[model samples]
Target: MVAEKDANAAKEILQQFEAARTQVGELVTAAEKNNQHFDQLIAADNAAGHAIINQAIMALVAQTGSIERAAGIIGIDNLNPDTADHEF
Candidate 1:
């Protein structure tokens, strides 16, 4: 009878461990999805900012007739949109 009781207790412990592991796995999956969504949003925002900067650079060049002067107004050395770094 004591052996039967111990076996039942062991089974219960095993079930609890499995439940905890499943819960942790679900949490990790959710977190990964959230991170991906956040990354997409950041990328879209960066692209939009890049477009606006290019527009401003073009307008400045048209008005000033000098790309260097436009770049100096924005406090950057080179305003070339194609080669500019967009890291923030």
Candidate 2:
């Protein structure tokens, strides 16, 4: 009868809605995992870059006197010894 058909249609609509919701949840989970993986990759790369930067900083500190002279040679005002007495 019409009542039974209406109930069946309602059930089908409900099932479809649930399927859509589940698919959305799955997609969101996958995206979140991908984002986490990407973040980890970026962090590792940054860590590597950090090591290089640290080594460069140490080398610059080691050659502090030459840095001031090199700065003058390169026309970079920031590297002048008279401007900043600090190693950085």
Candidate 3:
């Protein structure tokens, strides 16, 4: 009778282990899916940041070109900050 009781207990333990393993597998799958979504969001955010940087760089290049052209037209090819007079 004691041996029969021990066998039953062993069977119960095995069932509990199987349930726990199933739960752990589900949790791991959820975590992997969440990680994939997180990676996609990070990639999109990085792409947007790079786009903003590119726009700012283009704007700066255009502004610099405009300033150089204007300076050349006004006969100020090289304005020395140390010796130039600033009165505003």
TM-score of each: 0.32, 0.32, 0.37
Off by over 4 Å in 2: 1-5, 34-88
Per-candidate Cα RMSD to the true structure, in Å, reads 26.5, 27.6, 31.9
**How many clashes in candidate 2?**
0
Clashing residue pairs for model 3: none
| Tens-place lDDT digits, model 3, residues 1-88 | 3224455544544554455555444434534764433244345556643443444445444444444544454456785433135331
> What are the lDDT figures for the candidates, one per model?
0.45, 0.47, 0.46
Tell me how many clashing residue pairs each candidate has.
0, 0, 0
Error of 3 at 72 (Å): 0.7
Q: After TM-score superposition, what is the CA distance of residue 79 in candidate 1 from its true location, in Å?
A: 66
Would you give me the overall lDDT of model 2?
0.47
How well does candidate 3 match the true structure in TM-score terms? 0.37
Per lDDT, the best of the predicted structures is 2
Model 2: how far residue 75 lies from native, Å: 80
Please name the candidate that would achieve the greatest TM-score relative to the true structure: 3
Residue 49 alpha-carbon offset, candidate 2, angstroms: 29
